[model samples]
Target chain A: MKFGILVNEGPYTHEASDTAYQFTKAALEKGHEIVRVFFYHDGVNNGTRLTTPPQDERNIVKRWGELADQHKLDMVVCVAAAQRRGIVDTDEAKRHGKDADNIAPGFHISGLGQLIDAGIKADRLVVFGD
Target chain B: MLHTVNKSPFERNTLESCLRHAKKGSAVLLIEDGVYGALKGTTVSGKVSEAMKSVTVYALQPDIEARGVQNRVLDGIKLVDYGGFVDLVTEHNATQSWL
Candidate 1:
C-alpha cells in the first residue's frame, strides 16, 4: 500500500515525530510506498539542521534525514509552518535575507498543497500529531 | 475509516469527539496522551467502553508504555506496535486524525 504521512508535532518534546518515523520505516520495510512525508505545525522542527542532542541521546533531526536518505523519501516541510518556526532552506534564507539556512538534508520546504496532493495520490493518509 | 486520537481524554474531548463521529466497524487508534482513554477506569472510560461496542479500539504500545499506563489499559482494546499501526492504516481506506 502507498501512504501519505502527516506529522504535526516537534521531535523529543512530542512523541508524534518518533511514532511517524517508526510507522514510515515499518511501512517501507513492508514494501509499501510512501507518497510523501509532510511536516506541518511544530513538526517542521524535525527538519532543522541546527538541532543537536547529547552524545548518548538520539538526534531526532538527523535521524529523519538519515531515514530519508536510506529510503529516498520525499520529506517536505510546510513552507508556512517552516517560515513561522524559522526553519529555512538556502533559497528561503536568501529570499528572506536570513544569514544562514538550517534545513536538514532530504527535506524541502513546500506548500500545504503537497499534503493535499499526497492525500489524493496515496492510498492512505496516516497522520501523527499532538 | 481509521480515527487516531493523540490527546488525553482528561485534557481534551478529542477522544470523545472522535468516537462520536467514528462509525460502526471503524477503527480508533489512541496514541501519545490519547492512551489515557484506554485505561480500565477513568472519568471517561465508560464512554470508551460504550464506543467499543461498535468501534474497534486500539492503543499504541509504545505510547502506553511510555506513559506507564500499559498495566492499566482496559480489556478488549488491542495494543499495537509501530508495524501494527502501519497495518491498521493499510486496512482502513482513510484516516481521520483527531488532534
Candidate 2:
C-alpha cells in the first residue's frame, strides 16, 4: 500500500512528531511504500536544521533527516507554514532576502499543492497531530 | 476509513465529533489522550461503546501505557503498537485524523 503522512505539530512540544516517525518507520519496515510526508502548520519546524536539542534528548529533526536519507522519502514542508515559522530552504532564503538557509537535508520546502497531490496519489493519508 | 483521534476526550470533543462523522464500517483508533475514551466505566466509554456497534475501535498500547491507563481499557478495544498502527492504515482505504 502507498501511504501519505501528514504531520501538523512540531517536535518535542508534542508527541505527534514522534508518533509520525514511528509510524513511518514501521510502514517502511513492513515493506509498504510511503508516497510522501507532508509537514504543515507547526510541523514545518521539523524541516529546520537549526534546532539544538539537549545532548541527552533525541534530535527529532536529525532523526527525520536520517530516515528520509535511508528511504529516499519525499519529505515536504509547506511553503506557507515554513514561511510563517522561518523554515527557509536555499531558494526561499534567497527569495526572502535571508542570510542563510535553515532547511534540513532530505526535506524540501514546497507549496500546499504537494499535500493535495499526496492525497490524490497515495492509497492512505495518515495524519499525526495534537 | 480510519479516523484517528489524539486528543483527550475530557479536554476536547474530538472523539465525540469523530464518532458523529464516522461512517458504518469505519474504524476509530485512539492515541495520545484520546485513549482516555477507551477506559472502562468512564462516562465517555458509554458513547464509545455505542459507537462500537457500527465501527471497530482500537487504542495505541504505548499511548495507553504512557498515560497509565493500561489496566483500565474497555474489553472490546483492540490494542496496537506502532507496527499495528501501520497495519491498520494499510487495512483501511483512507485515514482522517481528528486533530
Candidate 3:
C-alpha cells in the first residue's frame, strides 16, 4: 500500500508528530510505500534544523531527518506555513533576503499541491493532528 | 470511513461530533489524549459504550499505555499498536481525523 502522511503539530509540544512518526515507520517496516509526508500548520516546525533539546530527551527533528534518509522518504514542509513560522530552505531564505536557512536535512519546501497530489496518489491518507 | 480522534473528550467535543456523524459500521480509532474516551468510568464513558453499538471503537495501545490507562479501558474497545494503525487505514476506504 502507498500511504500519504499528514502531520499538523509541532515536535515536543504535541504527541501528534510522535504518533505520525511511529505510524510512518511502522508502515514502512511493513513494506508499504510512503507517498509523501506532508507537514502543514505547526508541523512545518519539524523540518527546521535549529531545534536543540536536552541530551536525555529524544530529538524529534533529527529523528525525522534520519527516517527520511533511511527510507528515501519524500518529506515536504508547506511553503506557506514554513514562511509564517520562520522555517526556510537556502532558496527560500535567499528569495526573502534572509541571511540564513534553518530547514533540516531530508526536507524540501513545497506548496499545497504536493499534499493534494499525495491524496490522489496514495491508497490511504492518514492524518495525525492535534 | 475510519475516523481518528486525537483530543481528550473532556477537553473537546470532537469525539462526540465524530460519533454523531460516523456511519454505521465505521471504525473510530482514538489516539493521543483521545484515549481518554476509551476509559471505563468517565462522564463520556456511556456515550462511547453506546457508540460501539453502531460503530466499532478502537484505542491505540501505545497511547493508552503511555498515559498508563491500559487497565481502565472500557471493555470491548479494541486496542491496537502503530502497526495496527496501518492496518486500519488500509482496511478503510477513507479516513477522517478529528482534532
Candidate 4:
C-alpha cells in the first residue's frame, strides 16, 4: 500500500515522530510504499537542522534524515508552520529577513496542499501525533 | 467527513461535537492528548459508533506511547503513523479539526 503520513508532534517532547520512523520502517519491511511524510504544527521540528541532543538521548532528527535517505521518501515540512516556529530554510530566512536557516537537508518546505494531495494518491493515510 | 478529537473526553466542546456529528463512512483520528480515547471501556470511548463498522477510528501511536497507554488501546482502533493520517485527509471529502 502507498502511505501518506501526518506528523503533528515534536521530536523531543513527544514520541509521535519516533513512532513515525518505526511505522515507515515497518511499512518498508512489509513491502509497502511511503508516498510522503508531512510534518505540521510541532512536528515541523523534525526538519530542523539545528537539533542537538544529549549523548544519552536518541538523535531523532538524524534518525529521520537516515530514514529519508534510505527510503528516498518525501519529507515535507509545512513552510508556514515551520517559519512561525523559527524553523526556516534559506529562502524563507531570506524572505523573512532572518539571520539564519534551520531547515535540514533532504526535507522540502511545501504547502499543506502537498499533504492533501498525498492523501488523495495514497491508499492509507496514517497520522502520528501527540 | 473527517473528525479530529482533542485530548479531553469530558470537554463536550469541539471534539465532542465532531464525534456527535460524524456520519457513516467517516473517520475519527485522535491526536495529542486525544489518544486517551483508545481505552477499551470508558464512557467516551464507548460512544464511538460500532454501527458504522467501516468508519475508521485511529489513534496516533506516538501519542499512545507518550501517554503510556499503548497497551490500553482496544482491539478495534487502528494505530496509524503520519503517512496514514495524510491518506485519511485525502480519502475524505472534508477534514475538520476539533481543538
Candidate 5:
C-alpha cells in the first residue's frame, strides 16, 4: 500500500514526530511504499538544519534527514508553518530578506495543497500529531 | 474509515470530535500523547468507549510502550504496530486526524 504521513508536532515535545519516523522506517522495511511526508504546524521543525539535540538525546532532525536520504522520501514542510517558524530554503530566505537558509536538504517548503494532493494521490494518509 | 486523535480529553472533546462522524468498519487510532487516554479504568477510557462501540479502537504500541502503559491498555482496545497502522488506513476509504 502507498502511504502518506502527516506529522503535526515537534520532535522533542512528544513522541509523535519521532514515532512517525520509526513508523516510516518500519513501513519501508515491510515493503510498503511511502508516497510523501507532510510536516505542518510545529512538525515543520523536522526540516530545520539548525536543530541539534543534546548528546544523550535523539538527534531527531538528523534522523529525519538520514531517513529521507536512505529511503528517497519526499519530505515536505508547510510553507506557512516554515515561514512562521523562520525556517526557509535559499529562495524563501532571500524573499523574506533573511541572511541564512535553515531548511535541510531532501525537504521542501510548500503549501497545504501539497498535503491535500498527497491525501488524494496516496492510498492512505496516516497522521502523527500532538 | 480511520479516525485519529492526538489531543487529550482534559483539553476538549477530542474523542467525540474524532469518532462522532466515523463510518462503519472504521477504527480509532490514538497516537503520540493521545495514548495517555488509553489507560484502563480511566474516565477518559470510559468516555472513549462510550462514545464509540463495535468499531475497533487502537493505540500505537511504541507510544504506549514509551509511556509504560502497554500493560494498562484496555481489554477491548488493540495495540497496533507501524505495519498494522498502515493497514488501518488502507482498509478505510478516508482518514481523519484530530488535533
Candidate 6:
C-alpha cells in the first residue's frame, strides 16, 4: 500500500516527530511504499539542519535525513510553515533575501498543494501531531 | 477510516470529539499521550468502551510502555507496535489525526 505522512509538530518538543519516524521506518521495513512526508505547522522545523541537540539525545533531524537517503523518500516542508518558522532552503533564502539557508539534506520546501496531492495519490494519509 | 488521537483525554477533547464523529466500524488508534484514554479505570476508559460498541479501538504499545501504563490498559483495546501501525493504515482507507 502507498502511504503519505503528515507531521504537524516540531522535533523534541512533541512526540509527533519520533512517532512519525518510527512509523515511516516500520512502513519501509514492511515493504510498503511511502508516497511523501509533508511537514506542516511547526513540523517544518524538522527540515532545518541548524539544530544542535545534546550528544545523548536523538538527532531527530539527522535521523530523518538518513531515512530519506536510504528510502529516497519525498520529504517536503510546507513553504508557508517554513517561512513562518524561518526554515529556509537556498532558493527560498535567495528569494526572500535571507543571509543563510538551513534546510537539511533530503528535504525540500514546497507549497501546501503537495499535501493535497499526497492525499490524492497515496492510498492512505496518516497524520502525526500533538 | 482510521482516526488517531495523540493527546491525553484529560488534557484535550480530541478523543471525545473523534469518537463523537467517527463513523461506525471506523478504527481509533491512540498514541503518545493518547494512550491515557485506554487506561482501565479512568473515566475516559468508559467512553472508550462505549465507543468500542461501534468502532474498533487500538493503542500503540511503545507509547503505552513509554507512559508506563501497559498494565492499566483496558482489555479490549489492542496494543500495536509501529509495524502494526503501518498495517492499520493499510487496512483502513484513510487516516484522520485528531490533534
Which has the greatest DockQ?
3
- Give the residue spans of candidate 2 off by over 4 A: none
Error of 3 at B3 (Å): 0.4
The alpha-carbon lDDT assigned to residue A43 of candidate 6 equals 97
RMSD of 2: 1.3
Q: What TM-score applies to chain A of candidate 2? A: 0.98
Report the C-alpha displacement of residue A82, candidate 2, in angstroms: 0.9
Interface RMSD, model 4, angstroms:
6.0
Cα lDDT tens digits, model 1, A1-130, are: 8899999999998888988998999999999999999999999999998887999999998988998999899999999999999999999999999999999988999999999999999999888887
Docking verdict class for candidate 3: high
What is the full ranking by TM-score, best candidate first? 3, 6, 2, 1, 5, 4
DockQ comparison, 4 vs 6, better candidate: 6
Q: Give fnat of each prediction, in order.
A: 0.90, 0.94, 1.00, 0.00, 0.71, 0.94
Question: Worst ten-residue run, lDDT, model 5 chain A?
Answer: A121-130
lDDT of 1: 0.92
User: What clash pairs does model 2 have?
Assistant: none
lDDT of 2 by residue, A1-130 (tens): 8999999999989999999999999999999999999999999999888899999999999999999999999999999999998999889889989999999998998999999999999988888988
Docking class of 5: medium
Cα lDDT for residue A56, candidate 1? 98
State the displacement of the C-alpha of residue A19, model 5, in Å, after optimal TM-score superposition. 2.6
TM-scores of chain A in all candidate models: 0.98, 0.98, 0.99, 0.96, 0.96, 0.98
Please write out the lDDT profile of model 3 over residues B1-99, one tens digit for every residue: 899999899999999999999999999999999999999989999999999999999999999999999899999999999999999999999999998
Scoring each candidate complex against the real one, what DockQ results?
A: 0.82, 0.85, 0.94, 0.13, 0.61, 0.88
Pairs with backbone N, CA or C atoms under 3 Å apart (clashes), candidate 3:
none
lDDT of 6 by residue, A1-130 (tens): 8989999999999999999999999999999999999999999999989989999989999999999999999999999999999999999999999999999999999999999999899988888887
TM-scores of the candidates are 0.95, 0.95, 0.98, 0.65, 0.88, 0.96
